[model samples]
Target: MKADYKNWMPKGMVTGTGCGTIASLVLFLILGVSPIVPEGSAKKVIGIVLLILTVIFCASTIWMYLMYRAFSYNGKRQMSKQIIEGVASYVSIPDGGKGLDVGCGSGALTIACAKKNPGASFTGIDRWGKEYASFSKKLCESNSEAEGVSNTSFMQGDACKLPFEDETFDAVTSNYVYHNIPSSDRQAILLETLRTLKKGGTFVIHDIMSKVKYGDMQAFVQKLKNMGYDDVKLIDTTSGMFMNKWESTWMGLSGSAILLGRK
Candidate 1:
């Protein structure tokens, strides 16, 4: 995509950097006795202008930093709260349930579930795509440790061909991962996830359907239902706080929907 240079930079940083650079250049003129600001009252006016610009730059930088913190950590951001909720809802551990998080970037969802379900053990598997530096495996491990969740472990694995025994996990969750897969291989990934789930277990798939015709969603839902899933539910709860929490462009194009079923 082409860059929108003006708005592309966060307002705070842009204003700060632009103002600071201009101010520094102007300051040099003042010190060097350049003709730009001749020695009289004009120098005062230029100094005030520089001061105002400096303030703008500082404020903008702070605003940009706050925005970054709310959405993501390091460089990876949270998925929409609605999608997180959808995944969490399907992840059940009555006393104890073995859990698997496929495509678990940064281990945010994995760690959270592990903390909440103290009785359950959670495993997060991800290839840690290189789109962002925050997707590093070390970051996930550190995040898990920081959250103080011992039951969660991070591992690198292929989503389309998971390395696990069939019926290994009581609950499985995937968030916005399948859409990135080659369309032909998405089903294979879904089947692999299904294979690892125990009978009567819950599975949650949260992803965007903007690229395909609406009919395609119906067919996909039907396919899951045909696979012996007890109930298939689609829900759109992506708005407000949930929308602002993620950097995903999919949230902007269309809200996320959760496809949940039982094996």
Candidate 2:
């Protein structure tokens, strides 16, 4: 499970653009050119370029947030805590059973689950290369060690194509990882998850469906039903905190939704 930097293109662009803007601004300030062009050469061009770049930089920041909000849970302060609990409540982790977590970012939910269900072994996969995978891996390992849990493991793998054999896990979970993908490719990921899940096993998906209309919940439910999940549930925690801001603007965004099902 490698962290895919490709998925975070906007975040990276935002950083680069911000740095460029700052550099340009510093250079302009040092030059101290008159507000009006000395001879009306091309000062307006500079002003226009700066303005356009500023707009792009701001928009990129917003796009990064929008991407995060699209799949992340609204409860920024409580997301990691509540998600761990919410997921734990759904599965009765059996002793010695194996579990899988797709895109196990910082390993928060994965480690928490291991702590909650010591009887089960957990393997969390994420490509980590996209953002500090080595650091995150160390933290996840340390978190597990601190809890005295040894049955946990991690690897780097793509969500679109998991590396495990078919029916490898008794339960599988993903959090806010799918919406980043293009809408066209989402079904491929879902079908891949289904292919890996053992019959009668449980699968949980916590992602954002903000792109779809509210009326589509039924269609969404029906789609899962057709996919062979006997039980499907959609939980909206938007009323909690940080959701609206995350969805609407850059600074306060932290959007996420939940969907759980049994395969």
Candidate 3:
């Protein structure tokens, strides 16, 4: 069976918008075509309003469809695969080394990194909350089994407070996760992910680290360097690495970037 890594754009948004669009169109036509409200009345104003709403919904549906296609596995853009492989490339481990994937929805990153380093073991953890009903621990496990990857495991856990001890894994990585967490101190969450990394280990965390969501990320990089991390750098993935500027802006992902280096 093909692994179903759900889209970044939630299904409800598109479906709800499409439904609103159709409903408004039907109401507008009924008000205008039927002689129920008579000419030049308040009903005409309501019909005009509904017509404008239909236009907005139509545009939203088209935009969402394009974005869904871009993020899909078989998409022309394939942004998800590119970003997963890109993050996995940084997860190099020696034979018998262990790795961790925080917020591993659908196990895409964990599976990709596991495939890249067959000799190492990988663990993926997520709360599998109701906000994302499609992603779960079982789904991650099944995807690994389907890919014939025996060295990976999945569990339910929190990103804010990882279940592992400090300096446990040889490598740690996450993609587009931390920002989604509802916390005023998002930097602390980043540090929590880093806390599980062994000294001299590597980390690659990608997310919408816009200044609004994460304040002064460059300063955070400097802080990591001052704290003795080596070669810590923040890279803008929207510069054609995973997506271009236009695509990022179009998809409401303007601040997408990858933070990588050794601890």
Candidate 4:
């Protein structure tokens, strides 16, 4: 059975936008061909505006499709796979030790990490909210089974308040998760994830991490260093790890980076 790591670009958005673009173009054509409106200055202006709207909608639809293709596992770019593999690389769980994956949609990263550390086990958790209704706990488990990753399990949980005790895991990681959460303090959410890692435990959390969404991440990294966390560094993925600067900017992931280190 092939695992389905759904595209980051929602299918509904692409289809809906494509339909609107088609409708706009059809209306423009009908109006131009048939004298549906009187030949006047106002009609001419309306036609121009309608044609502009059609162009805008058409462009949006094309962009969404391109993003979907890039993010798809079967597509040429396989961007999600690159990001997942990058995050999984930092996860090092000792034999008999456990690791945790927050917001583990599809469990792709969790499975990758688990397969890499066969001596250890992993738990993947997510809210499984309506926005990504298809990414349920069952889907994660099924993906693991299909991928032959028996060391991993999954459950539904809130990222803001993980159910496990403090310093419970050997390692912790997440990918492109926290930025989507509507938190006034995204740093707090990062801290929440870090709160569950054992002393000397490694972590890798990837996200858009723009100044507008995360605010002064440099200061936050300094705070972690001050608190004595080891090897704390933020690496820019857009510089070429997962995507280029131009791709990140066009895809609205301009500040994408990986925050990695040990607790």
Query: For each candidate, how many residue pairs have backbone atoms clashing (under 3 Å)?
Result: 2, 17, 0, 0
> For candidate 3, lDDT tens digit of each residue in 60-95?
999988888888887788888899999899889988
Candidate 2 lDDT, 1-263, residue by residue in tens = 43121222234555666676676665444333555345353665665676666566667666655554443434244334555667656665789888888877767667667777789998988877544423356666776776667888988788888898998888888876776665565655766876787777888776655644122554677787887788877766455532454432443323345666777
lDDT for each candidate structure: 0.67, 0.64, 0.91, 0.91
- List where candidate 4 sits over 4 angstroms from the true fold: 30-33, 39-49
Alpha-carbon TM-score of each model against the true structure: 0.65, 0.73, 0.93, 0.93
- Candidate 3, residue 4: Cα displacement in angstroms equals 2.6
- Name the candidate, 1 or 2, with the larger TM-score value: 2
TM-score result, candidate 3: 0.93
lDDT of 3: 0.91
CA RMSD per model (angstroms): 10.0, 5.7, 1.8, 1.8
